[model samples]
Structure formats: C-alpha cells, structure tokens
Target: MENFDYNLVKVFCSLFDTENLTETARILNISQPAVSQSLKKLRNIYDDDLFVRTSGNMKPTIFSRKIIDNLKKSIELIELSLNQKGYNDNLFYKKNYNIVMSDLAQSFFIPPLCLLLDEANLNIDINILQVNQLEMEVKMREGKIDFAIGNFPALKDNINLISENLFQDCFVLMIRDGHPLIKSDGDFNNYNLLSLIGVDNNITGHSEVVNKILNKLGCKNKMNIPYYSAAPDIVEKTDYGVIMPSFIAKKYNFHNTFKIFPILIKENLIEVDVIYHKLFKNEKSTLTLRDMLVNNFRNR
Candidate 1:
C-alpha cells in the first residue's frame, strides 16, 4: 500500500464509468496515451486485466466488477470527508449534465428548465443528446447520461433504471385548417382514409406507438419521416394526416393553421417520465435535478 499511487484511483473510476478510453481521457482532461499508461499501471498494481476492449468498448472483468463497488464507496467517503467541513449546495457546483430526449421533448421542456436555472442563478450546463433507446440504459448506468425525459415505456421494466412518471400525454391527429376531406361539421370519421405522415424515430417510443395505431387502422399508404418538425409543414401543404403528441400538436396550432383531433384509444395515452440509473438515486446533484424536472412538468 505504501507504493500505491492514490491519483490512479481517479483514472480507474473514470475508466470504469466511461468504459471508453477516449471518453475517460476526455473526462480526466488528459490525452488518450496518458489514460492508457495510467490504466496499464492500475492493471499491474492489481495483477489483473481489469478491462477488456471488445466491440469498441471496454468491458469490465469479473474481478473489476466485484471490486468496483468498494472502490466507489472509498472514493465517495474521501469526497464526503473532504467536504465535511464545508456546506455546499449541489446546484452551486459548475457541472455539465447530459440528458437524452426527443426533439419534441426539447421544445416542450428546455425553455422552462433553462428559465428555472436562470432564475435560481445556477451555474450548470445541460447537454441534450439524441441516442438510440437500446443504448440509453447503458449510457445512464455508465454515467455518460444523467437523465432521460420522454415516453419510454420499455425503460419501466429495466431493473437498473428508475422511471418516474411526470405526466400523461395522449396522441392527437393534426391536419391543415381547411383539409379537403373534412366537412364543415368537423366530423373526423373519414379521416382514417387519408394518407398519413409518420415519424420514424424510436428514441422516445412515440413512433412505435404511432406505427401500431397506423397498423391497427389498416392505413397502408403512409410516408415515414424522421422528425416531428417536418410533419407540420407536410400536413399544411398536402392531404396527409399526422399522429403526434397532443402537447406538440397544440404548440404547433398556435397560429390557427392546423386543426387537432384527439385519439381516444387507451394506448394513445403515454406517460412522460424522468428516467435515471438507480446508482444515482442517492446522489445530491442527481436528486436535485430530478426534483426540479418532476416539479416543472408534473401537473402541466
């Protein structure tokens, strides 16, 4: 123990969290070669290959995984001991939180969140990342992402993740104000016959639900677009219908250029959630951010 370098703990923990040499280097503000050297030293000290690079990621060995919890606890203990003499609010720290969400969620949540941060005089950076749903859980567990705000139903079943429902949102059909197929009486029964414009992205799980609805309705003539922003313009210029979140449709209906109709199916109702890894449940910064997000969007 006398010959051990304590500074290597930072590199070890960062490597374990990131599982990517480049990312670990970036987080530690060091070059990749430096990170590699530190990792080599750690491996020699431990007498084991702690991590194995496979498929472009460093997968922790069983020994490394078994010891990681204690190592993390030791680090946390050190941090707590150092900060025990001072009282610091988590929000006062200048840190960057990476969040995953759909573009529609960004439009609905970012403005209010930024406003709240500004009002509180907090020095923090919020980075919005667009990631595949399959990778979201791993990223959060690795601490690469802090939070994910959207309608991710599948994440509810993930044991390692904690999904807190903020509010329930339903789907709505959007069309131009004077859509040709609709009568003046506002009857939407014949609307199913019109071609639809569907969002293809599945990050938020919105598109999957939309696609199921389309399939159930026997709607075959549909064009799949990758973004929600493009749907509004297409609906305005053509005879296509769009199924989207009610809040988003309402936001786009502000100019009275579009008409929104509710989809009454139970599956159309989606629970918007603030999802995070269970590992961060006790973390002050994470808890503070989670509370702020829940409070900001719960009832509205």
Candidate 2:
C-alpha cells in the first residue's frame, strides 16, 4: 500500500455511499478514469482492495469497514474546520429540507415552531419524521436528515453534531374515564401504571432515572410498556394508568377522559431538548426555529 492520499478519502467515501463506480463518478461529476484512479490510490494506501465489485456494487473489505467510522469522523472534522460553506436562506426556496424529530417533540414543540415561520413570512419547505433511536445517528450524518430534534445522545467530540436543551419536562399519570383513580390524586397508587422506556421522551432503552423517580412516587405496581401506542389502548379498556410527559397529557386533555396525577418524584427536573448537527447548525432557519421553541415554551 502507498502513503495515504488525503483527498482520496472523499472519493472513497463517495464510492462507499454510491456502491457503483459509474454512479459515484456521476455524483462527483468526475470522469470515470479519475474515479478509478482515486479508487486505486485509496486501495494502495489501505494495503487492501477496499472494494470488491459484485452485482454492480462495491462491497467494502473488512479492514475498510473497520476504518469507515474513523475516516468519517476525520472528514467531518475537516468539514467543520473549513466552514466556507454554511447554510443559506435562499437554499430553502429551491429545496425542501428534511427535519427528523421524535413524535413527542412534534406533539409539543412543532405547533409554535410552524407558527413562528408563518409569522416571520419565511417560505421554506420542511418535512418531519418520527424515528426510533436505532441507527438514528447514522441516518443524520449520512445526509438522510438535515437536522434532528429530540433527546440527542448523538453528539460526539469529533463528529459534526451540535445540541441545545430546549427545556425540561415531567410526567403525569393518566387513566381513562371511569378509572378508579379518577376521584383523587392520592388514588393513583391503586391502578397499574404503564410507562414508556424513559420519562424524558427517550425511545431507546430503560431509564434508571425514571425508575428511581417512580419508586419515590409510590408506584409499586408498574409495567415496562416499550411502545407509545400502548398508552391509548391500556387507558381505554380498564383502570390502568399510562405514564407520559405532562405536555402530552395536557395537550390531549387527558384530564377530561382520564385521571391525571403528577408523579411528584424526588429528583431533578426532566428535560426535553432540540438537537441538530454542526453541518446544519449555522442555518438561520434551524437556529430561529430553536429560539422560537425556547421562547414559546418560556411563555407557555
């Protein structure tokens, strides 16, 4: 293998993403020979044929796959250091930017955000997605999403991710109408509680923080309800209580149909944040939207 070619890393990443050399060349707007030459240089530097052509796609070798993440980080660091290109307001006019956010954030935060845009008379195309935690970071960096908003453990020291906490939120125990616990807040201990993985709108895994708080709140009877869909069904059929963010409980007016009780857990306040990567971090629309959220929640 020859010494590494700094510029070829971009070519290699493009090939990896496109899979086909022809398509990679087309996307890069380089001649086929130039792409082949770049691939050759990359292969020599890595001491392995990084790509094995099969079915018109380049399958990465094990060694190449192992270094892919680090290579990406380095490239991203370089991109961050060289910020000659930043997000422009004019781009919003021609292209629709994809905004990836959790269902919970969309429920509580998007209303005021959309209103803020309308009020300012900024014409921009936006699409929202509700995605789980698995491989969500990969999707964000791969350009699948221009920005992401929710609980972001996705930030890394070298990766081009930037995050900000919008505000804190808490949970309220809710149950359907005619629930035995509806009569009084103290009656909450009588019904079974179903809760999401975490109280902070996390869809990834169990939260020890939530468990500790619930333990303090006298929730001795609890079930690990993994999905959000379970909340409506369980609350409707029986006297079971579902735990969710206070914002959602209030938004749905759960107090009318169900019993809504504050957990009063002994701990720090739970918070919900809006996060985005550094590539799109400087985008005025993104920052403006973030500020609007902070303001709206403050007023709320």
Candidate 3:
C-alpha cells in the first residue's frame, strides 16, 4: 500500500462508476492509454484484478466492492481537506447533468429549472431521461444519473439513496369541458358512471396507488397508455377521462379544454421527491444542485 499512487484512486472510482475503459477516460479528461495504465498500476499495487469484463461492463470483483465505500469516503475527505477555504460556487467549466423523471414531472420542473440556470449564467446542461426504476439506484451510484425527481415509492427503501420530499400531489381526473356524464353542478359523485383512460402504472410509479383509489370507487379503466403527455389530447377529443397529477391536470387545463376534478379520496395524494445517490451527498456540485432544488421547489 505504501507504493500505491493516490492519483489512481480517481481513475479506479471513475472506471467503477462507468464500467467501461473508454468512458472512464472520457470522464477523467485523459487518454484511454493513461486510464489503462492507471488501472494496471492499481491492480499491481493491490495484487488483484479488481475488475473483470463481463457482458460488456467492467464488473467489480469482490475485493473492489468491499473497498469501494471506504475509497469514496477517503476521496471526499481529501477534497474537503484541500478545499478548506471553501468551494467556489461559480462554475467555470461546462458540465452536463442527467436527470430521470416522468413526463408529468418534466412539465412541472424543467421550465423553471432551465430559466434559473440561464438566469444564473451557469454552464450546465440538463438531460431529462425516462424512468428506469429498477436500474435507478445503480445509475445514480455510477453518476449516469444526477437526480431523479418525481413520485417513486420503490426508491424509498434504498439505503444507498437519499430522498427529499418536494411536495405532495394528488391524483385528479380530467374530462372534456362539456362531458354529458358530468352533472350540471360539476359534481363527480360517482366514478362508475365514467370509463377512465388509465396511465401505465409501470412507468408513472403513482398509477398503482391511483388504481387502489379507483378500485374503492368501483371505477373501470377502459384502456391503458404509457404517455402522460398524450392524455390531455385524448380526453379533449373523446369522452374517456384520464387520471393524472393535479398539477399536470391544471397545466393542461390552461385553454379551458378540460375540467379537472379531485379524486375525492383520502389515498389520492402522492409524494413527489428528489432522489440522489448517498455517495454524492457531500460533493460540492451535487450539494449545490440539491440545495437549489429543495429551496425552490419544497412544499410548492
């Protein structure tokens, strides 16, 4: 361990995160050969093949997995010690942040976030990716995703991830403005009278909860679709009502094309959260962005 080069730690972590030699080089701003040489040196120093190629990914060995958490902590400690004077909030270099969310969340968060970044003159680019709930933890840990913003009940159980509740949103039904099924007084006393266009539960995360509410109300789902953005148009041109987040229903109701009605049930509310990898909790750039999101959107 005395002969180990501390500089190789950065290479090792990057390789572990990306699981590809080429990607490690790209992330570290170095040549491929340099990254390869660093990996070789790390293997030699540890007397182990820390990573093995499997199914196109550099899967870490048992030794690597055991030591990774400590290595990450050491890196954070070193950075903190070096930056005793404090980190500069002004970002001078271009950085790209990948975020995962549903279309419903995109409509609510992207516009304001983009404006804030532009107004601050920050050299940051945001890539809004689609939901891959199963791989979300691994992606965030590997730095492939910076944050996931939306209601994801499945993510709450991961100890390696941190979740910050931004706000509580309830499910609402949207129907055409002059739907015949609706009462003249605008009361939705019975959901069984109207057939619903359901959002695919697998993608939206909140659909299962909404489904439970619908079951209690004895409502019937006529059809299922994967895209939330398509619901407004579908409901506007047809009698089929769609269930969605209240914020999203309101957003699409700007033109008075649809009438929004609360699900009128206790279990209709869902929590929207900002989730990130715990490993990056103390990282300067991560902290800045997380704080920005919480401050601007929490309880709003």
Best candidate per lDDT, number?
Answer: 3
Question: Where's the lowest-lDDT run of ten residues in candidate 2?
Answer: 191-200
Candidate 3 lDDT by residue in tens digits, 1-300: 775655688788867776789877865679999998999999998889999999998999999999989887887777666656432334223378898889888889998998777766667778999866888998887779999999888897898899999999898888999999888898766678787888884544787787788888887789898878888888999889988888888989998998888777888878899999875664567876787799889998
Candidate 3 residue runs with Cα over 4 Å from true position: 1-94
lDDT of 3 at 230: 87
Ranking by lDDT: 3, 1, 2
TM-score of each: 0.71, 0.56, 0.72
Q: Which segments of model 2 are wrong by more than 4 Å?
A: 1-94, 153-160, 182-187, 191-230, 267-269, 283-300
The TM-score that candidate 2 achieves is 0.56
lDDT of 3 at 233: 82
Q: What RMSD does model 2 have?
A: 9.0
Q: Give candidate 1 misplaced runs (Cα > 4 Å).
A: 1-94
Judging by TM-score against the true structure, name the best candidate: 3
> Tens digit of lDDT per residue, candidate 2, span 1-300?
355755677677767766778766754557889999998878766679999988868988888888878877777667555534443334233245677665666776678777876876667777987565555566665556666665454342325466556666776777777665444544555533443233334542225445666667645444555445556666677655666767777766654766577777565245555555553443344555556556666535
Winner of 1 and 2 under TM-score: 1
- Go through the candidates in order and give the C-alpha RMSD of each one to the true structure: 6.2, 9.0, 5.5
